[model samples]
Target chain A: MTAALETFDLCKTFGALKVVDRVSLRLPQGARHALIGPNGAGKTTLVQLLSGVLRADSGRILLAGADITTSSQQRRVKQGLVRTFQVTNLFRGLSVLENVFLAVSERQGASRQMFAAAGRRRDLIERAEAIIEQLGLAGDRHRRISEIAYGQQRLVEIAVALSLDPKVLLLDEPAAGIPSRETSLLLDAVERLPPDIAILMIEHDMHVVRRFAREVSVLVGGRILMTGLPHEVMSSQEVHSVYLGQAGQKRFTAGVPHV
Target chain B: MTARSELLERHSYNPIEALYWLLLIGTFFAFPNYLSIATTVVIMALFALSLDLVLGFAGIVTLGHAAYFGIGAYTAALLASGGWREPIIDAVLAGLASAGLALMIGPALLLLDGLPLIMVTMAVSAILFEAANKASWLTGGDDGLRDFSFLPVFGLFPWSVYGQTSYLYALGWLALLFVLVRRVVSSPFGVALQGIRENRARMRLIGSPVIGHLVRAYTLSAFMAGIAGAVHAQTNKFVSLEVLGIDTSVDVVVMLVLGGIGRLYGALIGAPIYILVKHFAAEWNPYHWMFIIGALLIVAVRFGYGGLLGILGRIEAWFARARGTRKP
Candidate 1:
């Protein structure tokens, strides 16, 4: 399979801290991948570098085999390399459909329409409504972003990203602020994503990782400690170090009934 | 789809919008003695409306919008002195000149945000103000630009001493620009602007050319402000360095804030309230006019949550609820 998104020895540093040190990854087209790490493992930093939110000090980023090492965030989004924020970063003042419509209309190049009412664009509304329905957010279509629940706000984030019609969707903690009760809905929506789009979900929720990911990587201290099948990566001793072992809980790894 | 359109239409300008204009028009007959002050209110409304595009909607913190206003004023005065006396044509040219100025400096100014943005905007206006002061030959320096008159509007109606033609002339421009600005604020581009104001970073993530959009808004805002300035020059029959002064810049923001920031209707309500009070209060007690204005601002700021329109909205909502309907 061809790699849809790949990074080569990507590096970023802040002051003396090497935040994302020599991270390299590849997500083949339609790959269901997860990047798991302990706190401060640079998972978010790596996503930022890939999405062009932050510049990598060294190495390159590629999307469908073309180098996009230093493209602007907007350019990267236009080129089918879109990302969602770890925190819900939506227009809080806008309604649910308006948030999604902005993305759909931007894709349709109707944002420059200076005279016509934006809501009157049926093509944009239909696409936005369809994506909202896909995410099971149809009931909340009339609500403003601030009026929606936190978990639903997270769903709106994904809906907006989907409206961009990306080839590679980078979800930075899609389930971060979502309640456990609602995460199942998020997972169901994730499962319903178009099969052709490559997804790299950066998650701390191992349940989601186990439930959705076919393959997983463990990251610690700004480096990937291991990458393999979900079960293999989770059962490995290195993953134990990345998760429970770091807080002087190495013994906890062995004390577990089953990894 | 129709439901969404209806929802959007309801969310737009209030139904009571027609009343404000009707009252403004009624002023020509009802308050003929005060038409001059009423006309000033109309001009300032347009100016404040232009500021709303950048400062109110796009959330660009600016301190030098008067640079455009001054440019428009000077453009009209210069054109008039140069024997190009068509007022409407001169105003259009003034608008283009101001927009051209925005094109020159908007890129650099848009790069900086927050405090630096405010400082640079102030500096731009100060620079323009000084240039006018020093260039006596062209701009008349401290003496102000004078010695020019406007041709009869459309070669049909000449300007009158009782400020009759100027009142109607200014009102016509205000209505036309208001409709244009309303359309702009309702369009996709307008929604994008509000998005930029609310969450600029998110806008970039959504694939918007943030700086490019800001530049366009800034330029268009400058164009509108220039038109107001040109109208001011044509109606008042004079131009001064004050048109580009920092006080002029600050006054527009004050007008917007006192009226309601980000509401085009707020500019209309706020400008008239301000100028009318300034006119009548100064006539009553010129020495204590500042105190009167200060007290009005204090009461408005402390008690008026959304300014007058916001209060009007609350009243409308109250009435709607009283009638057991969501809207009236």
Candidate 2:
């Protein structure tokens, strides 16, 4: 089957420093993949390129088997590719439902309506409420983004992406700043997403990566060192000797070996 | 709560908003002698209302909205002088002329944001100012456009020096256009503009045409500003080059900022206060009147971050707490 999302020979640079260097990746439909990397591994930059925020210097991106290299960001989204930021970027001033409603109305083509009040639209409201309800934020539906807890804010990021009905979702460190207790809700939210959609998560926690991603790619210095099954990648010596060489590596793989 | 109650609760018309309109209506009878200032204030309020759509809701941060205002004034002036005696029809035509120009140029201009957007806004008005000055044969040059009189408003009431006809005429336009603006800011299009303002890139990722939506809002703003200018020309029986000047642009910004920014009422609040204070203070003490405006700005910025409406909102919250209502 064709990959749901694909990048071939993708490269980007900022002046003298190479940010993404000829790195290629793919996610087949329904595949759960993880990109594991240390700091400054260009994971976020790659996400930007895919989302068309940062133009790639020389590369081609395909969405469901069509070239979208020069497609605008809105066009990419309309074609079923979406992304969330590494940090919680939300409409802090507006209510939670309004934020999600923006995404839903955009997809439904109701946002362009200049005459009807958005709240009066029963269909838009129902869809927005259902999405909010599914994320377990039914009680906080009327609350502002600033009033929500940090963990819930992270969930909101994914909530917004899901509202777009994306075929391929790129989540950049959704659980980066949340506490251990808070991570469960974020994990649960991720697990409950529709199965047919491909997910590529950039995660630092090996436990979460092992639980969600069937395949993993290790990135170092803007290049993918290896891509394989999670077990093969964890056991590979090159991934070990890089910088997760000492205590960090042991913390992830102490008892990771399977019988 | 059920979705029905939630939507109803938020959308229900507030008594406070009703009172604001009531007070505006009362002004027509409350001070008959000051009708001239009242008319001017009503027109300025409409102008500030136009700027609110661009600067307040969309966060466009313009410094040259006077371009539309002047264009509208000139369109009406030229048409009326050329024998278009109908006031209402000319005003609508003037508004469309302004909106048309906005739709044409706004795509390129709205692409810029923050300080650059501001500087470009100023430059656009400057160009219009120079254009009007050079097109003296048509716009009447710096001497201002005159030698024309509107037919009795709708060919009924005659306009005269008592300011009665002009006052009521301008107020009618204000009320009618106010309703239009009210409908606009509550629509889904307005919500998308807010989204674009808060997070532009995210809006695009959600499939919103950022620049396209902004241009539409900008066009609407131009239409409103145009109407204000057209009304001013009709009411005053003149259209000075100053209508298209930089000072007019900055004053509208001050009015909106002082009244409030995002909420529609903020424009209503700011414009009347700015015009009334300047009108009376200049008559009382010509040299020092600006000091009062400067002081008022300081107080508004320091005490109420959102301007007068912000202060009013806080007061309402305090009263609610004091009453122990704890509304849900």
CAPRI class of candidate 1: medium
What TM-score should be assigned to candidate 1?
A: 0.93
Q: What's each prediction's TM-score?
A: 0.93, 0.93
lDDT scores in order: 0.87, 0.87
Looking at model 1, the pairs that clash are none
Each candidate's fnat: 0.67, 0.64
Q: What class would a CAPRI assessor give candidate 2's docking? A: medium
Give one digit per residue, the lDDT tens place, for model 1 in B174-224.
999889887887888887887788888888888887888899999999999
- The candidate scoring highest on DockQ is 1
Weakest ten-residue segment in model 2 chain A by summed lDDT: A250-259
Mind giving the per-residue lDDT tens digits that candidate 1 earns over A74-157? 888998998888888898877888889888878888878878987566778889999999999998887888988999998999
